[model samples]
Target chain A: MNLMSAISVALLALRVNLLRSVLAMLGIIIGVSAVIAMVSVTEGAKRAMEERIASFGANLLVIRPGSSAFGGRRGGAGTATFLTDADVEAIRSEIPGIVAVSGEMSGSQPMVVAGENWTTNVQGVHSDYFEARDWFVESGRAFTPAEVRSGARVIMIGQTVATELFGAAGPLGQTVRVGAVPMEVIGIMAPKGQSSWGSDQDDTVFAPITTARSRLFGYQFGVRDPVFTIYAEVAPGTNVSHAVADIEELLRVRRNIQPGAEDDFSVNNLAEFIRARNETETQLGVLLAAAAVISLLVGGIGIMNIMLVSVTERTREIGLRLAVGARRADVRNQFLIESVVLCVTGGIAGMAIGVAGAYGIGNLGDFPVSIHPAIAGIAIGAAVFVGLFFGFYPAHRASRLDPIEALRFE
Target chain B: MAAPLIECRDLTRVYRMGGGEVRALDGVSLTIDEGEYVAIMGASGSGKSTFMNLLGALDRPTSGSLKVAGEAIETMGPDQLAAFRNRTIGFVFQQFNLLARTSAEDNAALPLIYSGLKGAERRERARARLQQVGLGERMDHHPSQLSGGQQQRVAIARALVNNPRILLADEPTGALDSQTTVEVLGIFDRLNAEGITVILVTHEQDVADHARRQIVFRDGRIVEDRR
Candidate 1:
């Protein structure tokens, strides 16, 4: 049959059962909409994490104290022994491609200022700590070399501490008791809010490495056992693996570890963290895609069910057309067109609903939402394919019907 | 002087039922000329309908040769037969086979769909045919809206739309009142006068009396050939 007749017949079929057509198409709409919406929300979450990761300077590399475990319980809180100041000096003096290295020893400490006390994390580090972590002191001044040499009792408060301890007056050049030790506040750090790990990073304090070592932990190099963790930042264009190997070699030599002995130190980078997160996102994407596929199958089943009923209903019509000179192919084409039209229409409706759903979720989530063209294209293309694939058997059945038998049927 | 438009030699059709073979048409031979209004008359189960079906190319003969419009239909595939039927034969059914919810014009244009005419051209031709069948004012009206005689007229117009060489009608007036039957017969007479070969199947004597020639069949064979 010609294009005109095929289209007219399909239109007539739809018009005849407007409500049934809509109901049949609802399945496809829901399937496509759910797929698109779930994918969009998951993609949005992934993008948000990537952006947070990006905010931390890409050049920065963190030197923690343990190897990253695979599928094991997370390494946290005293499992990895605290690294010492000697480790930091050894990397600075001996290791090549090491730009800025600072040993950090952070712990939560109760602070009091005029009886207004709030607990906050206390980071003890050298002057290079700011440059190493890419953070800056927003007020007063960071600890100087003279203060580190003298082991002066001066501290740098974070924004949250400044606000809680000093109120509206600001805490520059004030004194706050750090665990019953009165330390003069020298600097205040800019707010960094929560880290990507969801830790309250801003509610913390900073102090010189010497003061924290001598006063808080009560240790001084070999004479007293010292406990401090080290953070090292690799230089630009330096291979992190090479830097890590170099640091390991230097530490092994400095600590006098024998050859073939296991070294007790760990170096981590942003790349590893990003890779883990990416793998997690990839799994999520696959899960969502699989769910979408299942829904599409359900939609296709719905279409097939409806088309089979249509074939049964139009049995006499098929017979009459055959008797009046319609070929089997023509009969098949008519039904196929009907099925495709139903799906395409459903796809369009699904797109609308999906887009609206995405917008609603994006606003409710308070995160960025991306509506990419490739997603819409995939949805529509998938819908059409589902329609055609599922609609085939019914159309074939209609076309293969015997004209004589069909005509004789009531 | 000219070769007959329809010719069948020992045409036979068999049906398989309940693990047994039932011959619907044993062996039938017939010939029909152009512009002839012929009727195949018989009671129920006399194989008259089967013979008509084979003649119209709506069914394939299980055995024997059948030809319509000088083409041997016995050797043709379903697709080829469909094309041949579209090109050379028109069918009128016992119940007017007009599509429900479709305009009379569209119903008439159904056969032309196989001819691959454009929408406008098809509609125009359908309109002209409907007007010729005295349904000019009811071109856009649906089958349910029209009377039985009007519906049959639309079916007849659909049959003639392709300008087939032969019109094969099965029980054209079987469901109609005498008045409507006479009206349908008047339209058929007019068509036969216009040199369209008309073959009608009917048991009603008054319906058969309208035809220029008639044939009686018994047990799948022509019992009497009267002209």
Candidate 2:
């Protein structure tokens, strides 16, 4: 038969047994939609991570004290806290690519202002810490270099803190009292959203490290001239690894560490951090893709099974067609078209459901889900391939039957 | 004279069973001219059905020259045989064999589907044949909705849809009641009288008696021929 008639006949056959045809297509639907939903969600998460890495200054290197052992007990990272002001100053003066360096101390405390009390994160840093972190004041000014020599009781409030402590009145020129100490809000820091680690970046108050050490957390750590963490921003067109090595060498020399002894400090760069996270995400993406492939395979086998049953059930009809002069190729094309039409229809439905499912999951769980236009083409192509691969044997069998024997079949 | 619609010479069909062979049609030769109403009668396994299969070009003979419409059917390939059947032979089966859930027009037009005809032309030819068989009013009725007599008539219309050289009927009335059988046989008589060659293969003597010529087979060979 001609192509048009063959297609029409296949469609008619499928319509004749509508329930069975849909049931046969179910495996393909589930398989395709599951893959699509999983793939889009994975893509969404990867993009989110990349954007988060970009949000923070990409060239910032975080320097902190390494773990220390005392009396056979090893302490956690940053517990040693041997980093001093001399080491920070030497790095600031010594490193060539160090555009900005700031030594910071942070603590969590409740601040009260005019009968309003809110517990939030507080950071103590040099004024240049804003430049290192790519964070700047939206209004007012940062404290100057002279403020470090004589501790100043001044603070800059983050967007969240300003909103919490002063409501719509704004926190600029207001007094935020921490325990018995009162610090004036010199600035409102620009807004920064959630960090990659799922913490709010805008819920902090910034003060000078000299003031924080002499006034608030000095009693807690019991250290003199304590500078635990240092943020160093590398200039554009500078090699970060070389700068990191230079800082490590300068720190070792200033701290009087001999050659071949393990350094007491550790440097963590943002690129390495992102690489580690991406490795884990790539592994997860592969796992999800494998599951999707398997589901498609199972769907293909379902088509094969249903096509076989259909061929057997219609043996007599096949005989009648052959007797009426339908070529063997014509018979084969009819069954092939039926299978392809089944999968293509199922695949389209599956794509719609998958995108909807991805969005539904995204809304419910507060995660990202991105759907690419190319995924639809892939779904349809995969479905046609599956139909052809699985439907061939049954169509061949139908075409090879002996017309006389088939007609006589009960 | 024009070539006979069907010609057979030394026609034989052999089937192999476990360690044995059964000759279904053994060296039987026959000719059927155009515009003849002929019946070949025999009991089950008497080779009447085998002969009909060869005459319709549905089965190849083991050794013979069988021609239909001036083409040597036994020497034809599978595709050629299919085209030969489409253009030259029409078949009516004992069970009617009308596709269920299909309208009478579509069922009758089945042969034209393989003839490379378009939908409009196929429907037109099928319509004419259905009207010829007196089923013009019920053209849209499905097989399930038609009576046994009407169903058989629909099958007859399907047989004539291709305007073939001969109509091959294999126990065409076997599934019908006595009244329906009479009605179906009457349609066949009218078609044959209109200059279309008809071959009826059955064991019922009364059914064979309606034809102008009768040939009886026994043990894969013809035992009697009467005109």
Candidate 3:
């Protein structure tokens, strides 16, 4: 049969059972919609995690203190005895891909700024910390290397602190109290939204390492010499895994670990972090795809069932067509095309509904939803395959019909 | 002037009925020349329908050779037989088996479509065929909307769309009124005059009389051949 005739016949048959076709398509719509929605939510989650991991910079590596014991406590005491500024400097100098590194000392306290006070966390770091973390001042200038050297009480506040301290008025070059100590806020960092870990990442202030080490707690080695996490940036285009390996070796050697002794440090790179996030996302994606496939399978079974009924109902018609000179292939093609047309139409409609449903869920809920083109293509392709696979029996039966027997069929 | 258009030698059709056998056609042999309007007359159980089915390539003879338009029927597969039927023969039925849901134009267009004509050309041919069958104004009408005579005329137009070498009418006027039957018979007479090979299968004498020659079957065998 010509393409036009095939299309017309398929369309005419679909039109003849318009209500049934729509219902069948609704199954596909729900299936595809679930696929799109699930993928969107998972993709949004992936993006959220990646953004949090990325805020540390593409070449950034986070070094956290690994497992440690103190006085046989054998549990976390909000401090670990391992990581230090020397380790950070050693990595920066020895690691080939490492460009800059900084150790963080975190302290949370109520800060009073110009008669307004709010409780916020403060992190003390070297001057190179801004470059290593890809953080820059949104207003005014960051604390200079000289200020960090002199242990000057200069600080950089996040946008949230700036807003709370000065309201609509500018807070650049203002003074804020940090644990009964006054510090100069030379700059305000730009707003970084909520992290996947449910923390407002920018709701804090940054102070010079010397001042935080000397002025606030009065001693450096007070609590098992535990400070904060160390962050370092590697050079661009450098293999992160290689950098991680090099950093691990350097830390092990510096810490003077004996052979077969476990190192007391952890190095996390962008690739591993992103891989971890993607692994979770991929699991969720598979789950969503399976659900969509189940619905599509059910829809396919429904089509097969309905087609079998159609074949039985049109037995005499089939005989008449065969008797009137229709080739078996023609009959086969006609039914095959009908099945495909139904599925394709259902797929399209389902995709549309899925997109709409995704958008609705995204807007109505806190979950982020985004429609991806690859997912839509996959859903539709799967739907078509399901249609063809399940539709075979009925189409074959119709095509193999003996005209004499079919005519005689009641 | 030439070989017969259809030739059958000892054609037989056997049906297996629960370990027993029934012969629908037994050793039937016949030849039909081009442009010959011949009728195959028989009672309800005389196997005329079986003979028509065999002659139309809708069924294969269980034994013996049957050739139509120089093609061997027994050797042809289902697909080949279907193509041969589409290309070389047009069948009319007693029930005027028009597709119920299709319009008259679409029904007529079916054969042309099977012949691989494009939609525009098929529609044009269908339109002309319907017009020839006096359904010009009823092209869009469904078979259910048409009278029995009109439906039969549409069926005839559908049969004629591919310009087949032979027109096989199996009780073509059996379901029509006498007046409608006469009108339909006039169509066959006109088609015969135009030198198209026409084969009519009927039990009615008047319907059989319209053909130039007659063959009568009884108990699955042709008992009389008259011209």
Candidate 4:
């Protein structure tokens, strides 16, 4: 039979039992929608991670003290202060591609401002700390060189700390007591929102590293001017790996680590972490796609099951058509076309539902979700494939039925 | 003389039942000329239905030389037989096997689907046939909406819509009342008078008497042939 007649016949059959056709298509709809929604979510997460990497400075690197073993007791990372001021100075003077470098020490302290007390994170660093972290002062000036030389009790506060301690009033030039030292707030850093690690980024204060070492926390035994971590920025167009190698070599030489001995610090590439996160998202996307495909396969099985039942139910109809001179292929084509129509229709509905679901989820969760055209195409194609794959068996069986027996099937 | 429209030489059909074989048609032979109204009368299991099946090209004889419209039917492939049936024969059944929920016109146009006729032409031909069967006003009515006699008329219209030369009916009026039976037989008589060959299978003598020639079957063999 020609395509038009086959399609018409199939449509007639489906229309005769609309409820059964819809029920058979339900599996395909759910499968396709799930695939689309899952893919969108993964893609959205990947995009968000990329944006985070861009915002956190792609050329940034962090150097932290390595774990130290003493008397057969192993200390965790950053437990030993092997890095010193000389190592930071050597990295600045010796490293060729270094753009900015800052030594950073961080601790939590309760601050009193205008008779309001709030516990907040406090970071001590040089003037270049803002540049290395890609942060800028929103309202007031940054600390001057005199502040670093004199170990001045001046500070920069973040938006959250400002809101908590000062409320609606301007925090610049306000006096806040950090632990036992009274400091003047020099600047309020721009809002940085949340970190990728889910920590509040704008809930901190900053001071010169010299002031923090001498005033806030007393020096430990056998350590002087100690800092926890060092932040470095590579120049634009310079390879971060090359810069990292230079810093490692310079630090090793300055710290006097023996040849063939482990270095006293660990150099970490920030972009590498982002790339790993992307890899994880990609793996999750693949896993979700596989699950969706399995669901589609299940839906295809549902189509096959219903088609087989339809063939059995229409045995007498087949016999009648055969007696009226319909070729066996005609009957097969009719049923196969019917299944494809059902699946394609379901695929369209599924695409709409999936896109709406993704939009809803993205808005509700405050994330980005992108629906790729290729994914939609794949979904529809898979639905069609499922239809053909599952429809063939029942159609073949219907085609091979004996007209005499079928007519007598009652 | 022109060759008969249908001719069978020593036709035989056997069915396998649990390692045993039962002969449904035991070397039966017959010839049906064009434009003849012939009735086949037999009790159940007398092979009358089997004979109708063979004549309609719905099944092949196990061993025989069967020809319809001067073509060897037993040698034809399944597709070729189907095409031959489309072009040369029409069938009416006792159950009036009209497709449910389909309009009478569409049901009548079913055979033309294999003919590859365009939709408008198929419907046009179907409309003409339905009018010929006196169901012109009910062309859009589904089988469920039509009475038994009207449904049978629709089936007859569907059979004739292909413009086949031969009509093979198996107990065509078996489900109708006597009055409706006469009406259906009248249709058969009128179509036969129009120079179309009609072969009907029935056990009722009254139905058989409507035909000009009668053949009776007993034990898968023809016992009497009379005109």
Please give the DockQ score of every candidate, comma-separated: 0.60, 0.65, 0.69, 0.59
**Per-model tally of clashing residue pairs:** 0, 0, 1, 0
lDDT of 4 by residue, B82-111 (tens): 898899989999998889999999999989
Docking class of 1: medium
lDDT of each: 0.82, 0.87, 0.83, 0.87
lDDT of 2 at B195: 89
Better of 2 and 4 by TM-score: 2
Clashing pairs for predicted structure model 1, backbone only: none
For each of the candidates, what fraction of the native contacts does it recover? 0.74, 0.78, 0.72, 0.68
The TM-scores that each candidate's chain B achieves against the reference are 0.97, 0.98, 0.98, 0.98
lDDT at B189, model 2: 94
Candidate 3, superposed: residue stretches over 4 Å from native: A22-27, A58-61, A64-82, A95-99, A109-120, A138-147, A150-154, A165-188, A215-217, A220-226, A233-285, A359-365
Worst window of 10 by summed lDDT in candidate 1 chain A: A65-74
Model 4 off-target regions past 4 Å? Answer: A57-255, A275-294, A363-367
lDDT tens digits by residue: candidate 4, A100-214: 8888888999999878999998898977778888998898988876797689999999999999999999888889999989999989999988888789999999999889888
Question: Deviation in angstroms for A38 in model 4?
Answer: 1.3
Alpha carbon lDDT at B64, candidate 4: 84
**Candidate scoring better on lDDT of 1 and 3:** 3
User: Candidate order by DockQ, highest to lowest?
Assistant: 3, 2, 1, 4
User: In candidate 3, residue A176 scores what lDDT?
Assistant: 82
lDDT of 1 by residue, A1-410 (tens): 77766877897898899999998988888888877877787777677666666555555566655444332334554554556676777778887777788877767789998979999888778887787777888888888878876888999887878888888986887888998799999888877777777777678888887777667766434433243556677787888888878877876676566898665555567756775776765676688678778888888899999999999988988988898788999999899988988888888898889879888977985645667777778677878798889999999999999987787767
- lDDT score, residue B132, model 4? 94
Candidate 2 lDDT score at position A159: 92
- Pull out the clashing pairs in model 4: none
Range of the 10 consecutive residues with the lowest summed lDDT in candidate 2 chain A: A67-76
Residue range with the least summed lDDT across 10 consecutive positions in model 4 chain A: A68-77
